[model samples]
Target: MGRTNGGGGGSSPSSDSSRKFMEFAERNARLAGRLADLKVGSAELFLQTTEQTRMALCISDPNKPDCPIVYCNQAFVELTGYQRDDIVGQNCRFLQGRGTKPEAVSKLRQAVETEEYTVVDILNYRKDGTAFWNAVHVGPIYHEDGSIAYFFGSQWDITELLAARETIVENERIATELRHRTDNLFAVLAAIVRLSAKDTDDAAELSEKIERRIEALAGAHRMSLTGEGLAEDKSNLRTLVESVLRPYRNSHADRLEIEGGAFDLSRKNITPLGLTLHELATNALKYGALSTVDGKVRVDWKETEQFVEIHWIENLGSASERLDTHPPTQGSGSGSRLINGVVRGTGGSISTDYRPDGLQATIRLPIKNKVSF
Candidate 1:
């Protein structure tokens, strides 16, 4: 969580020639003489209210072996609980605690050594040795000869910001769990609709279909607990296809046929496509050509240069006239409609071909990582 920003100690007016500036310079010279080590300050600025803001301001000597603290504002003193006298000449490491990140410290060391501005988050310790999170902004200063001058650093307490972020993450987790529950509910509704068709259906067949669908719905919900993490696990493409076809593997029935050369596909795309595959298989057995043994079914898929195309071609030998000479339109049947919905939802394209040979449903999906394309 390291981060960086701008601080304003780079320069001063190099061309000041006016009488007022000259008089101010003269006063500054006298002040420097009286206090050689004291920092120069602007009277107007010191009187201003800008110093009391939420930001902490400090200056450091980076070239020093310990990077000693040179100056700190009143706000910095209050935020850190270290008065100017107590902090001056002390190594900035006094602000660091056990929880401070070593990587962040390395980044700061590099930025200061290189005399460049860098932003990072580091855990810091207060005078009481209590730890706090700080957004530290650091930059280097240079002399006229381009030699190291000193390091100027500022810090912002961001413990509250980090806490708020944690809260948001927790809320998001709850929302995701709720969404999965809702999706399963929809799956149940879809399963019942598929079983209740326009034609007369036997109770035994209905029960079997319902049971299969319930298991499929269970599969959808089970992916998280049993399946790999949403974005982490590697997926076997062939194994994925097999998993989707599991519900249609009825021994006594001849409803569907699945054939393909399954390679390992990326998990990101396969899971959604898998669910859509199940919905399609369910629909075919209920209302499509899979309803009768004379109704032959073929599902074949092959990979192309940029995508994978799965062809679900259903043929009705003598019942073509009864159903139609063409493939039924999506949404006309609960199963086709379900397939269409899942296909489109997963960034895939689907089209039904009307032919006397059979009703062909082709779904084309990307096989690469560029989903936006």
Candidate 2:
């Protein structure tokens, strides 16, 4: 005060501060009013905007229908085949039939009592006796004082989804059991191969090998009982490719190498694949590169999102003969029609490229298997 001076700049700064505070207060008041309006009318807003949405919805009084259903949308009515008049004011128990589980009801009760949100899969009936899987979600509504109000719920018909899950579980169970049985079978087969390998004599060795192979044929048969491919198989795509060439493996005395990832396939196709491989092996041993020494075979199978391609390549053999070199006699046996029949029967395509390098069979089968890993 002793140094007091009247300054226009100081007075102007104070006025500007006052103006800014007043403006901020006005904006905050407007925002507060809008938030209050939305908080009070959110339920009505949701009903007006999203009532016709595909997701089934219902509004009910949690405190009180017998367990009252206050509102149900068109989707709910259509899914359950109930008219508004038929469902409104009534307990949802009308939708419960023989399929309803008491445990789910207990959970629902617990949720309502605790004012907690609950999501559950429940069995419900339609207007017809047809039962369907219903996914129900129940949550508590709160009043201004944060006291429990009624309940809000949503129901979705998951009958198809539940059915699909069941099917998958069944398939997985079969796959697991099949894998165990197949593992035992392969153990026996590997032991036999080792036993057959014991004899060093060429002719006897070959004969024992062939005998062991004949025993391996039982693998497919065993798989047929339970329906699965080899347990040794680890890749679904490779299993598919191997199915095409498995019969051919060890069919030739010459080295045949299977190169690729592990795949899993069903027993449905395992038999055919085993049989096909057998046919190819028989042909190779009798007339193909395996008939001679210095001959080797390499099998490489690759899978992509769009296609699965298997390739069979045989190398130059000591008994090398041109692929065009026909047999002395053109006699027709199962040999003449085997590969063509199998491929054509499945409506798949086969292309054979016979070169001086050996026989290269490229099989392109469209990807139709829907596999879940």
Candidate 3:
């Protein structure tokens, strides 16, 4: 009975140890299974997030030749209009086309070589050959050992944004041009008012003279805008001169003559040239040759490869005596200043000679290269 009791006690301790060991083993196994399930769940969640995200996402394996695409999300496929089977193992550079800028491509290439994060605005083409502006971001995915494992890229379509920005820039440029034109018109009107006041003391006469000058200016402006009395996209020298002199011609058709070959003028030069001709004609009607019936005025022009030269000659006839009595002034008068300002502003030259027999004027303007306005 003593031996049986000792053996039973020893067996009891052994049984207790085996039971405890079995309990520990079971707890460890359960923990390992839970850990495995958590890992799988995390991977599935990551894939779901990437696939459902609005921004296109792609991954390329660095270990592969050419760093070809190994994984791409649904959004990426939709953005590029490519199926997974078609794009897999293909280099992302397949998206580039002829319209893609070299500078942008260079930047992306440099970033990839260095495994650095970079963002670029690139022109990319879809599988169907449609183009879109893409704002692309690329960065390296590193392993725990600090080695590059893959390159991850994200893309967003930015075509509309770029177009909007361009539209805003064009609007600003047009506004600036309109403002400049308005200021120039106001200045010219103010100068006319000041200059016209010097010639007449009678308020009615001054008002009439000012009105006539403004009308002439308006006529020139209309021709410039409508391209009337001019060529399709240019101004004809003879046509413009005759149009400006038409009002004076009605009364003295026999007294005025114009002689010029066909010559084209830039649109920018039309306004200034018209203003100068109008001023000259007005001065002749009031104080120069055209004040008398017998007086005659001749206008002519010649064009060269580099310049267009114009000549104005007045035969004073019986009015020749007035030059001795009145003695034509130099460029001291307001009328002369007006003529000078408009002519010189266009990189042209003008000169006037008050001879004993008549008044003579010459103008030379540079010929600029043709351009679309």
Best-performing candidate as measured by lDDT: 3
**Lowest summed-lDDT stretch of 10 residues in model 3?**
1-10
lDDT by residue (tens digit), candidate 2, 1-373: 0001211111111344345445546765796688687775757766765566988887666545244787888888888998999988876667888878989877876665555668988899988878888999987554433444456788988889988998898789878867855664565455435544443458775675547455545744554454333333323545544454555553642377778776454443444345445545555666666766667777776765654566767675665667565321113333334444444434454567667667777755445533211
Model 2: residue 4 alpha-carbon error in angstroms: 80
lDDT of each: 0.63, 0.59, 0.75
Best of the two (1, 3) by lDDT = 3
In order of listing, the candidates' clash counts read: 4, 12, 0
Backbone clashes (count) for model 3: 0
TM-score of each: 0.46, 0.45, 0.64
Clashing residue pairs in candidate 1, if any? 2-121, 3-119, 3-120, 4-119
Q: What is the lDDT of candidate 3?
A: 0.75
Those runs of model 1 whose alpha carbons end farther than 4 Å from true positions after fitting are 1-118, 121-136, 140-148, 152-174, 177-211, 233-236, 247-276, 279-298, 303-307, 313-331, 353-359, 366-373
Full candidate order by lDDT, most accurate first: 3, 1, 2
Highest TM-score scorer? 3
Q: What does the lDDT read for residue 37 in candidate 3?
A: 74
Q: Model 2 residue 4 lDDT?
A: 16
